[model samples]
Target chain A: MASGGSGWRTLPPGGIIVEPGSSLRYKTGTWRVMRPIINQDKCVRCRMCWVYCPDAAIIETDEEYVDSKGRRWNRTYKVNYDYCKGCGICAEECPVNAIEMVPEVK
Target chain B: MMGSQPERFKSKFRGILDIPREERFVSGHRLCAGCPVGTVMRMLTKVAGKDSIIVNGTGCLEVSSTPYPYTSWMNPWIHVAFENTGAVASGVEAALKVLKAKGVLGKDVKVVAVAGDGGTFDIGLQSLSGMLERGHKVMYVLYDNEAYMNTGIQRSGATPWGAWTTTTPVGKKWKGEWRWKKDIMGIVLAHRVPYAATASPSHPMDMIRKFEKALYYTREGPTFVHVLIPCTTGWRFDPALSIKVARLAVETGIWVLYEVEKGKFRVTHKVRKRKPVREYLKLQGRFRHLTDDDIEYIQKIVDEEVDRINKMAGEEVIGPVEA
Candidate 1:
């Protein structure tokens, strides 16, 4: 077993796995400093943030959210902080100014 | 109501960032922080979309992303030797063509070949030229960082004159590299490919437009894109200044942004009032040892090149070339 007990000995010599998406095990969330907060009311469901996120941290959701302004939204976007590197490219590219980067509490 | 909008309008009207997230290159790769290559790769992959195959040459991008145990590419990627990216891409394109003809591949898949300047301008030139001559449907991208950074900042054929590298160190009698940078765009264009362009990571919008144009031209023949990727470590500049340095390269006319489609030249980002070359040269440590005469020499050459490109773009020269 390797350090994380994934049974490395069971694998081939180079730990080669003839598969894809195995990099998902490496969590990169610790790279974040400022987190993106999406304002659903202002969002036009444009998916701009989702597109520009270099880390692919932005996920589209069918679930709706009521903003502080009491506006309801049928579809929204969520930032998967697990992989977001706080690049702020999403906030910079959001056409409607719906995404804001706030200081990470932790 | 928004959903009711025409799909064509939605697709066309959306900004570069408004496109759907189809990331083929994921994070957690080991590219340096604030590295322009990462951004360039991300944006290029986004433009390439999911239905694309990437052929990478042995360079920083390759060595960093794919270690033995892990790989960052979500799309089908093939890693080739430093000098054979273009040859491999041709084979992949040929295979895809056969698959499509035999009804094995039901969808259209784009082929992209990526390499650094060392691979494209020097070692891989033969393969690249062959691929272009053969008219493979591959979009070849050369991320020109000047020197071979991955191999300890050695001087390469693409290293500009008066730039310092390990192999071309500044000595008492000798000053850095004594030769001008190779005109790779000219060499690539000589193949008579349908489309080719020079791009920089600093201008994201321009890069996106150029990539889209290159992809469009892939249907006709092969296309080539040369990107000036600023090397923070090798160039001895702060990592954060990578984009700024790249922008300065364009503003000073050192890196002219232009595209040639079907043998016609057009300057994509025309600088109405170009800055002096020294404004760009002084920022990097590679040019720290340059003398006044050297600076003047560089300025003169840059001005001449800018004039030539502007003339091709059919723009009137506003003022005399200044040193």
Candidate 2:
């Protein structure tokens, strides 16, 4: 949260951004396994959503969920599509059974 | 201004060899082909140069490089068990200090300890904590390859989330290594040592500079260098792509290049535009089970952590810092 040069360094706008064009040039390696799906309505406030994330992929908000933002409600949990591994733990760990596993499309 | 052109060129385009060549890890020992640690060890010793002593924890590097009579280390190096190198290095420093006090040993020799993630994060943490608290005049380098690669690929505390190690298999019931890597750097940085930097074999020259900073920054205080060394044997990657894989780590922001000196943080590699964590994870055999949504989830975390670090550096807040 600390801004200004004295405290911490910020990534310049272009800093550390991966170019989309470069993605396919190298081998995509292995990831063709499992996918994760989430149901927002059944989700509770339990932070279990944030704890088990290995890739640190879960996003939770403290604000109340509002429909006006067009984004999922605040305090509502959502997966950051950019980094989720779809391991299903988030769905599985949801105490309310709000998440489900779908077959990963090839 | 006229003289500035040649001077600027000399400084700007400096090659790596200008770094130094005092080898601590010698050649002709056993290490896996294309082991990332080998490259780190070579570059590290080059920076530490000629006058140094190393305390090696028992791991692939220690096991492979120092098999009995044959030693790959040219400098004065000792292999204590997996959990005691920090303590051992502390003793080395204390002994040198006592000897110096008694006018027995010269003050030229530097001391450093090399450890794996298993050694640093899980087993040797107590010793490391003690050394940092005591502030021994030594350097400790943790070659992080995620899991415990030396021990047939078991999961360590440093293994990333969603990674499939032998212990943390991905199955119908299980996803992968369940927990996140413990932030050892944050813990070490809290000690407020004279220097702490994360380097990668991908940036050999930058790595050399970090090592030099550690070796010479103080003859009487502790310093820690965490290097991201990719392991092919455990991660199941082509051995030849070790350097490339290491590069991907930085490029993708899964692993960052930065330093904290006296609590001032500076991220060296300007990622300019960040790479997705999936890009880094997808290259290795370990994360093969990850789905697109999974990749997105991981990307979110990587971005959050990066933002957290950058925020500490006072950079713009990007994503998921609350997590």
Candidate 3:
């Protein structure tokens, strides 16, 4: 199926993935036009967004954050733009309306 | 992850974030955006833990997760043909048994077999039947997205009645799929599986708990978990409303969350007053052609199913909606 250079013979033996979970190498961040932005100050860290995320785009970091309402969240959830498909489930499922889906600009 | 029984939830609602934080089913795969199975996969691999071997079938999860050189599976996995997921999984379980007996393997490595509705309810049914009948120690999970979603959303045995698909297109003469969705839970129960349950993507906690129960019962025999994952592409809904659609399935009494364990039937998520089926059908493009009478017919079936489960459970597990 190769156009010019190396053909199918160049692929690994048996097509076994030497590096497990190697799909991380192919970034899917470009698939989204609407990127979900998590407002740390408004987030309650209930992990509602994190749990519903299909892409595992919602990264749970060790970084702690205290919201504007004095709620201390042990971990912060950030959108890993690299693989986010911008499905808007995070924004829709967020109980506190902390996640806002804004259009991604080039 | 193995040996000990899964700690059951208490009176308090378990925190969704409190579970194991490891990302076993990592990102960068090719599953559709807002795909319900991705959420299920995250919870499933998280609950199953890393000390398990995942036996995936030729379905969407396999096609998307492992595209040639790249794979999203952090745990050991084997993707086999469409019709022999159970046979392959049984072989893997047998291999594990021999390894343990021979002192080559120490830790209790759980074998999890995952297949789509087509695999479980149709083509692979015989293989699955043999596995369950033989009492293999594998937690068989059927992700019922309701059709052959991997190959352009054709109607399968699991496709519910009155819903449109590529094979069962709605037209002047033909309605949607006339055949009722196959009762897989009933089939698994018939095989006398140690633990069997039906789960929905809307309830993650319930789904995770069911997965845990299935894992725990692997020591006894093969455990079957059937999860209703609303397909974003096939079901023809806004990808964002995936979870909502799943919830509507439960809320409308179309999908029941129950488990059959040691001959005892229990309803997990019970609805007090059920919504009209139209509320769920209206959201999806596939069911857009369903008329009022068509919806009424589906509603009758849903109501009867709710009552049937309630009768089977010997309690008013699902409360009826007073008109």
Q: Which candidate tops lDDT?
A: 3
Docking class of 1: incorrect
- Candidate 3 per-residue C-alpha lDDT over B1-323 given as tens digits, one digit per residue, 9 for 90 to 100: 12456654332226675667788999999998999788999889999988999999889989999997789999998987999999999999999999999999999999999999998899999999999999999999999999999999999999988889999998898898999988888888998887899898788889988898888778889999998898889999888899999998898888888888777888999888888888999999988888888888888988898888888988887778647
**Interface RMSD values for all candidates:** 3.5, 18.1, 0.8
TM agreement with the true structure for every prediction: 0.80, 0.70, 0.94
Stretches off by above 4 angstroms in model 1 are A1-17, A27-106, B1-14, B317-323
Interface RMSD of candidate 1, in Å, is 3.5
- Superposed Cα deviation of residue B19, candidate 2 (Å): 3.5
Q: Candidate 1 residues A16-62, lDDT tens each?
A: 44555555666777877778888777888866555445456778777
Which candidate number maximizes DockQ? 3
lDDT of 2 by residue, B210-301 (tens): 77777755553789999987887788786546676788788777888888766778887767666567667877888899889888888778
- lDDT by residue (tens digit), candidate 2, A1-78: 223574225433323222211222222113314555666666655555453333234565566764533556446666
Could you tell me how far off, in angstroms, the CA of residue A68 lies in candidate 1 after the best superposition? 12
Measured against the native two-chain assembly using Cα atoms, what DockQ does each of the candidate structures obtain, in the order listed?
0.23, 0.01, 0.74
Model 2 segments beyond 4 Å from truth?
A1-106, B1-14, B21-24, B316-323
